[model samples]
Target chain A: MTKNKNNILSTENLAIGYAQKKQQKVIASGINFAIKKGTLNAVIGKNGIGKSTLLRTLSKVQKPLEGTLFINKKNSNAYQHLELAKTISLVLTERVPESQLTVFELIALGRQPYTNWIDSLSKKDLQKIQWAITATNLETLQNNRCSELSDGQMQRVLIARALSQDTEIIVLDEPTAHLDMHQTITIFELLKQLTKTTKKTIIISTHEINLATKMCDELIVLSENKIYTGTTAALIQQNAFENLFASKIVKFDRALQQFVIHSQTF
Target chain B: MKQKPYLKHFILLSVLLFIFFLLNISQGSVSIPFKDIFTTLIGNTDVKDSWQTIVLDFRLPKAITAIFVGSGLSICGLLMQTLFRNPLAGPFVLGISSGASLGVALLILGSSVFGGFFLTNSISNWSLAIAASLGAFLVLFAVIMAANQLRNTMSILIVGLMFGSLTGAVIAVLAYFSEATQIQQYLFWSFGSLGNLSWSEMRVFGSIYLVGMFACLSVIKPLNSLLLGENYAKSLGINIKKSRIIVLVITSLLTGVITAFSGPIAFIGLAVPHLAKMLFTTSNHKILIPASAIIGGMVLLICDSIAQLPTSEFTIPINAITSLFGAPIVIWLLLRKKKITI
Candidate 1:
């Protein structure tokens, strides 16, 4: 009933892993971070650096091996499952429906948590669903089947789904994983706009470190068996953002504002 | 102000069902006049014994059985489609129907193994029902086990297909060694007929279907979330394991009973669900499930009527009628669209 101040999600010395495993072997242990509500945060790391694993753990899709994750200063485990769903909505990089599901119908799925056994969508629910579609610039596509949308459009549809869920914390795992450069920029801009307009904490993992560095308010970098979190400027100041990738082949050339793979030797 | 187009289709289908009911009552081998059929339904016909037997024993039970079997198979098909998240999934895909047939066959052929108590028993119907249910449930159990071991949908589907084929092989083996008379009886049953049931036999079918439908209604919420994926459903407070178990049980029950009474009437379960989805573009099970039930009932009734149209003097096998409509739809779906996955 009462909302906590500032911190939407905080991990304190947390170790995350699969629940089926008996022992808590940390993916990246002793990690501490707080995702403040209404902030647009980008989590950047090299592929296979456990960025997705960390995201899943923070979203409570998987259990942490050790330590605690708190929502509003209360233990996350204290929240009921549906309560958690109402608080934190997740968007995976999975495929959308290939069948003919109109955008309106797809977005309405977000209200499923509030629906009864009959899966009825009330007028209020419809209003929220329409709002999500409009916020994601999906008005024209509302009548179109998801199968008919472009990859970028489909990605927005998925985001609209999370928005319709009406959660305070929205977590997206590599939301821009399947898009062209133009589409990627479109999705990122939309993500930034959504964070500001909806005032929801947005945490997303991306491999596009350069774009994320320029666009995101805060950046969480996972590298070399450790995790680092700070604003993009602060991370650059601490020189911790430069070591995200191996330096031998490609180096982060801050002057150029991008990674430059070795070319002089060739 | 928005009206679902399918609502019109449903109403039209209902009208057609009424027409079929009338035709079925009047067009039997002992062609009762339309006037006589109406009088008979109104409990008149002067309480004549022969006419009463024709109405109650010959026509009424057969027509009701057609409606029930059609609706039941279609609902079972709809449930499988949603649960497996595959358009091709059906009651027999998971081997439940074959399992039922195997159980029924065992009773007809292997009953002598159970001694005289089984042979002279008045409780044979219940025993046959139980055996069929167990057989279907065994296949369901195997499918669930395979699902546990294999997480991929395609693999689970392949496993289910193999299980069905294996059940078919067992049935064929059993059929091979059975007495000629028993085989002949089973073969006739295999062709499928709604005419076999009397009014008393419908009691069990009605009760089982009611229970299955109720179970399905209770699960609409979980099923909607499941369309997103198991992980997504779990995130939404649904116990995915429990929901899966309940759905599997309900599908098995409906499929088993229909197969037990009417034999495995194909395509109604497989095709009707897809038809329901096409008519109603929403993925929400609330609309899809019930819509599939009614549409399924209508399609089956139509098919049953067609089966009865062997020049009106003889009945064609129901399976033959189903394959006529079913096989082409499957080919079109495969050629036109990629398989629907969750």
Candidate 2:
């Protein structure tokens, strides 16, 4: 719990969006937030919101439209591409192209930043890969081809790949976007455990607002053309969830910690 | 533990390659005995003079050509497949061979159109090789330009295909008006001749191929990271643009050089990588690159041996022979895999 006192990621007056040659489209502006070490943070919003753009900007996969973003108290842009890779790992939503690669080979690729030019894994590198596989409960599936894995298992393997990266933070986009409720909960629980046990910050953008409120250490709500950042309890007390949707058909039920549809008297 | 399987496969492939190498030299038109072939290879004077000339002069360079062309094309195919993340990608998929053919076609057919007497056999083989390289380089340059302008790999692939068809159309037109003898020469070149290279040409081929192979070795890490997808690869600290350019350059060098010498030999580039993947059951390029090279050499040697038709003096064209053997394996693999994800 003491690790939460240290900030691992922070953004100030950040503008997120796309920029053409002469025109710029800003999704969200004046966003200020800090992510603590060893915490699981979820960014949740309705569809077409700028959750993904914000994540991409923070990760430096795409440049921010305006303002400053910092990682480990240093300007994110100041870190070289290779240095940034060592500090943070990302899991994208895209399916891995099918290769004849086994789960073990796939995970070992996480050591690329440290591996030799020929990609030979050292003893420590191999041990880290082993630890990642074991931590993710992928020992039995290590020799299986990635193409053979189910959706949930593949997601876990990707998480293990990030773990093997041995970075200070992990960023995932829609980690459970295509999963069943059970699988979604499993992934959320995994992230929660990973953040606590490994003392690594984890950030994810998801549409599972109810689950995020229940399990996340902090929530960043992108709604109403603004960014809301706070602990789950503080955000709820601030009535942030009420403004998340139109509140016409579905409404947030504070007491039950979930959303409910209004019953129509026909 | 992982190294053990790859090592075993490597050793198996090396053995097959050695066997094929010996077969390639010994099973030509004259069918020299193994002992005579070996003795002649080691500079002994015990063998018949004709057999010595046959083995050292003819068979040696031909077998060496087969090895380099096979390994070069297959490695280029592996690089292309990984770069594009498309299973159908090959060394020539980017129109490199078509470009080479267009060059050769222009030189051979163009000369006849400009001057009727030029077809009396004044043009040298060196000019054809240069023209082919120039043509391949031009296409490669265009592809690289398009690749820089386009971020999508599929678009680059489409542009390459279009370049190929465009070159093919030009070659068709050139072939239409050329004299019969000129057309026959171009046809012969297009059919692919692995046996015609002199020692000097083989030296050039060998050096370029070795350099390309070394370049491939340097990029194994990036290539393996790329299997996940380019975005994931970039996240892993791979410079995607740099890797793509390096892969394209190496692929272009290998495909262009071999096409210059061998005339766009078919199917080995496309099929041998798949063969290596299925046999090895791993997409790790560290293993696949060498495996494909060895398997490619063996496949080409086998094809070349069959092309020789040991009983007759007339040998078949290597291009036709490769398609004969390689196309069916590719088709079968496609049918068997059902999904072309790789």
Candidate 3:
């Protein structure tokens, strides 16, 4: 693969997995991909297929079992921990620990990497937090405690927090995992708009392949013991969605660009 | 406008704490008048010598201890609850107190089995403090190691509980082998006392508590990030392992020192942080840390005042007073809120 100057993140022969003492479990290997700047991308795979693991590795929260990852034309390993935080922010699916933090306070936490040792927000930090809240449409709920928000609203708060981080790249793990159909679509649209307006690369691992394929500029499909990375339409032409779920009951309809029931047995 | 309620609560609590501090010093065993107490505090020779001695030497040190123990344990509790992300977590939940208790127990009880030299010779308070700190540090080291090895918070909690029970069993065995006098001494130590601290001990305790408070201040940012979860905290550039170690060290120092001096005073560490969170209505540690410390100090002052039994010459054990008062508030808060969060 050619190294594109526009690429914000890329992996070469990457192997992602967990390693214990004298034992290694390779979840996926020989992976190669590049994510360009200002693009919305999605990693879609079946349940328990290492989508989260892949995201964790890319965000540098976990170490890749093998191979190299490059961010902004430099080896990812060379970036200091604080520098990496400024380059890539992440939103995970884990429940926020029980907190009475208001939406504003929670979003301001995103400015942590930029804040001084005391973690006080300056005028510039406050402006960034306000922008994140406004962008995520959380203006009205700024004072409400995080515990009181709906799952969809909470997800947005998490996104706003990532926005406050003000990183060049934002990665989310199943950002819409527990949302309704409408909320999920809204989140996808929000992510797309964020990428376009902020010119920040946004990558999300999601199970909503149909929506992702429709909205995302790029799709990374994990299937058939391999990784497929390309434009959504190009991946569709390559029939990358065919083996997403190796089951007879559900099938990906290339024509309709959605999944359909193969049989009326149910 | 957004910070109005928090500021109001802080002012209210601070005023209450001041009143409680005055009440705590004024109505001790001899029941000195508030005016006399004030005069004594400001270096006025008009106050009676006995009143001055009681106020300056006895009641003052006890009140100061109350403040240190209250603030230190509450902040430590807040740190633990956030680190474990469990509502039930507290300063003692990680067995730091148990470790301290074990140390005290060994000194008091083990002397019987080992020829009674240390106890008969009158072991110094410094030795006891050092032993308790060492025990607490050992447990803290073990917990940190387990935390690094296992990512599960619940497992770490269980491991801590196991260490507590294990220490408890050792204490029990020591009790079994000890004479009744040694057992009585050990029992008295277990009862917890805030008034026994000398002015010199208070200075040492105060400085250590200050160090722990400073540590708490340094980690407030990371602690706030942790409210979202470890993954989110890590994404925010928090070194989770480092934060965990710092929290443990601070907690151990606070709990160990307090327990060494006061014999594992309970309830304040477990209850004060929740009270602060409820009153402030925010989990931002910038507010919660100081708020919890103030409230904790106030609560302990109230408890200490009641334990003094102002009207009567007889006083009650502070541990009993704290449990009786604090346990109910915790229960009421839990029931009223119907949910508890870190």
The TM-score measured for candidate 2 stands at: 0.96
lDDT of 3 at B248: 79
RMSD of 1: 3.4
After superposition, candidate 1 runs with Cα above 4 Å error: A1-5, A19-26, A256-258, A264-266, B1-5, B45-48, B111-126, B141-166, B310-313, B329-342
The alpha-carbon RMSD values of the candidates against the true structure, listed in the order shown, are 3.4, 2.4, 1.9
Q: Rate the local accuracy (lDDT) of all candidates.
A: 0.78, 0.88, 0.87
Write model 1 residue lDDT over A1-266, tens digit each, in one string.
12337777888888866655375545677888888889889888888778899888888888788889898787988988888989888888766435555777778878878876677778888889989988899998888867788888888988998998999988999989878999899888988988888899999999888899889888899988568788876876777767878667878777876777876788
What TM-score would every model get versus the actual structure?
Answer: 0.91, 0.96, 0.96
Residue A261 miss distance in model 3 (angstroms): 2.0
Clashing pairs in 2: none
Docking class of 1: acceptable
RMSD of 3: 1.9
lDDT of 1 at B180: 82
Q: Write the per-residue lDDT of candidate 3 for residues A100-181, one digit (tens) a residue.
A: 7788888888999988998877889989989999999999999888888999999999999899899999999999998999
Better of 1 and 2 by lDDT: 2
**Candidate 2 lDDT, B191-284, residue by residue in tens:** 9989877888888888998899899998888888989998889999999888888899999999999999888898998889988888777787
Q: Looking at candidate 1, what is the lDDT of residue B36? A: 71
**lDDT of model 3 at position A255:** 77
